[model samples]
Target chain A: MGRRIAQIICFAFGALLFALYFSQHPTARSLNTAVMIDYWQIIFAITLLVGVISFVRINLSNIRRGDNRPYRIISLVGLAVMPILAIIWGIKGNSPFMWMFEYVQVPMQSTVFALLAFFVASASFRGFRARSAPAAVLLTAALLTLTSRSSLEGIVPQFITEAADWVRGNPSMAARRAILIGIGLGSLTTSLRVILGIERTWLGSDK
Target chain B: MDWGVIIAGLLTLAIFSFLYRDNPAYKMAESLLIGVSIGYFLVITWTNTLMDLLFVPLTQDAKWPLIIPLALGVMMFGRFHKRTAPLSRIPIAVLIGSGAGVAIPAMLEARTLRQISATVGPLVTESGLPDISLIAVLVGVLTTLVYFYFSREHKGALGGAAKVGTYFLMSFFGTTFGYTVMSRMSTLIGRVEFLLSDFLRLTQ
Candidate 1:
């Protein structure tokens, strides 16, 4: 009974929204905007809070089990501190919340992203071996792109940049376009399946 | 003293410490990052999303239709318990269904139709010169699509086209990697600049 209701709601909303896309009426447009913007955001926000609760519960259990207790405690502290700070100081300019975001969160986020450079370089060193024709093409293209983009761009011959630009414009663009087309078709099919109730995987049960 | 810069620099170093070896500092920094990010998002969602969108409009403007989504959002909390878990499915279904519905037309127009139109442009330029790049792109697209078509066995003409497609795919991957590395390197340089100029006061 519960599953049937859920499926009905899913099909109803999905079919309604999909049908709404084709309409030029003002009411349809407003309905689409309201649901897509307001309703979606509200639901998504609540879902995120649910996720955070789950995360906290898991971490708390881990801490209780003495699984890296100190680090887990520090993590919980960080989690608890942000909301408290926001509540006390608000999230306005010069507020402690903004201060933590600017100083602590942003820096760590960027550093983590930056850290990927080392891993990428190391992976490339091991993986960029040109043992076959396709591998050679990959290596050549990578080198051309890297050299053209690097500080050595001025010192390198003009043809290198031209070749890199050509590769990016032609073959690379084609590959990406093909992949995009494939993705579009796949998404369309999957969406149809979901709306039609053919895809029940999201229901989280076979029964 | 600029405590902001000091704290940021120390945390940045702690993250970078993983390059040497994973230690307590790195673990602590990683855990803190996860926790703080969740908290930050939670606050933003509350203020920017819930309070501004739902509460304000529902109370002041009397936009009663907002209650539908509000009820759905509340239903998401049902997931916390075992018996009430099934109730969460309705909201999840609504989100997924609507999202999928929107995605159908959106993906078709943006990803499929536009890309095909772009790819199938004139092979010859206005000046009457044979556009080698366009020809190459046409071939690349066709061959790449052929490579993805798995129903047919790779033999004869299909094999050759698929082989060429692999080269194009590899070139695409390589170019993407190059760009990714460059972006990461730029971020790394910015961190180094911050450490030297802002934190250490070594540079102008």
Candidate 2:
């Protein structure tokens, strides 16, 4: 009875919300969803506690085992302190949460991304070599767009920019539309799998 | 010069250290990032999807109508248990039925018809100087489609078409690579700005 109840609730709600999302009504569909999403944002906020607990357990155990003492200590402290300060002071305005997010997390994520630029340069120099006929045409189109986008327009003439406009507007847009159609079909299929319970693997390891 | 900048710089070094050797610092940062993300999302889904989709609607809107589906979702959880789990079938079947209903039309329309329609356009172009764009599209559609045609040896007419298709592929790759490079460069620029403006007592 309980199990049946859960499944019914999941489907009915999923369907209703899905329909509501598509509907024109601002209140019955959109606003209700926005409110629910806001309420559910609590879970991620609360996950900070779960993260700290798990980190402390793992790092403390690592230290006790004399394995990775120094790095473990760093994780242990960072996990413990930042959230406590943020929670006590509140996250908005001039709080520790806002400070740590802006300074630390934001920079780290950005720096990691910055490093990806080096990878792209290396890949372009090495991986983009045309071993076939079709590859050559693709390379030509790619080079046009790349030069157009980059700061190289000052050195290269205006003709390249015109060619890029032709490629992007007509051929590329057509391909993109075709790809979007495929993606839409793919997503619809996946949603169906989940709804039918054919894709219950998301429920986790058991069934 | 500031302590905060020093630490961030070190963190950068620690992370980038993987280029040479597998350092403990890099591993720690990577693992923490993964663990935190996973834990965070699990909590998020429980609240966002489960609570909102399964709980609130049943409570606030329809009462008994929700009971059957809720029972199905519960049966899903039963897979975790050893017995009585066969009860999961009723919900699972209904889900499959509904899924097929929703997907069949969408897949047929979007994937089959619309996709084909997008490829189907005039052989000529408005600019019309040999219509390289049209030629490119025609060749791309023919050869790339032929690249899949696999029944015959790719030597004569089809082989030549597929050969031009290679140029199409290369240009596609090159564009993707360039965009990726620009995106990364922007990230690097942002980080540098943060370090310069926020951490250091320097330029705003």
Candidate 3:
């Protein structure tokens, strides 16, 4: 019963939105904007709340089980503290919430991303072997691109940068364009399948 | 005392400690990062999305249409329990359905039609000389598409084209990797600069 109603709602909304795209009428445009902007944001925000709740629940269970209890407790503390701070001091510029964000979240986040550089370099060293003809071509292209972007551009011959630019503009662009077209066609078919009820994977179960 | 610099610098070093080996410091920093990031996003979403978009409009302006999404959003909470879990599907359906609907026309126009039109133009120059670069691009596109087409057994001419396609794909992958590494290195440089200039006061 629930599944059928869900499917009906999905089809109705999908069809309405699709039809709305073709219409240039003021009412149609406004309705489309309202759904896309206002309703979408509201639902998305609620969905995020639901996710945070699940995160808390999972951490609580882990703590109860004594699996990495200290780490889990720290996580829970961090989670709990942010909202408390926000409620007390508010999220304005000089608030405790913003302070935590600037000092804690932003620094750690960027450092984590920056850490990827080491792994990528290590991975490339191990994996970027030019044993075959195609691999050699790939290596050359990579070297050209890297050098062109790096400090070596000033020292390297002018032809190297020109070659890299050509590779980027011509061959790279062509492959990307083909992939994009393929993605578009694939998306169109999948969307049609979804709207037509041919795809039920998102419904979580066939039953 | 500059507590911000001290706190941020310590956290950054704790994360960087993973390079030596995963220790207690790294684990704690990682845990705190995950929790704090989620918390930050939660607050932002509440302030920028829920309060501003849903609550303010609904309460102050009395926009009754927002009640529908609010109810749908509430329905999402049904997932917390087993029996009521299926009720969450309704809202999920709406999100997925509308997303797919919007994507169809957008994808077709931007990705397929535009790309095709762009690719299928002006193979020759105005002076009647052959434009080799344009020719190469056309061939690259056709061959790449052929490589992706799995309907037939790749033999004879198809095999040849597919082989050529692999070269173009390899070039694309190589350039992409180069760009990714460049960006990551830039981020690493930024962190180093922050540590030296902002935290340690070693460089200006």
Off by over 4 Å in 1: B126-128
Provide interface RMSD per model, one decimal. 0.9, 6.4, 0.9
Q: How would you encode candidate 3's per-residue C-alpha lDDT over A63-127 as one tens digit per residue?
A: 99999999898898898889889989999989999999999999999999999999999998998
Q: Which candidate tops DockQ?
A: 1
> Taking chain A by itself, what TM-score does each prediction score?
0.96, 0.77, 0.96
lDDT of 2 at A152: 90
**Residue-level lDDT tens digits of model 3 in B1-204:** 899999999999999999999999999999999888888889889999999989999999999999999999999999998888998998899998898888889889998999999888798899999888889889999999999999998999999999999998888888988899999999999999999999999999
Q: State every prediction's TM-score relative to the real structure.
A: 0.97, 0.64, 0.98
* Global lDDT scores for all candidate models: 0.93, 0.58, 0.91
* Order of candidate numbers by DockQ, starting with the best: 1, 3, 2
The lDDT-based order of candidates, best leading, equals 1, 3, 2
User: What DockQ does every candidate get?
Assistant: 0.85, 0.21, 0.83
lDDT winner, 2 or 3:
3
The Cα error of candidate 3 at residue B169, in Å, is 0.7
Chain B TM-scores of the candidates? 0.96, 0.72, 0.97
Error of 2 at B72 (Å): 14
Scoring model 1 with DockQ, what do you get? 0.85
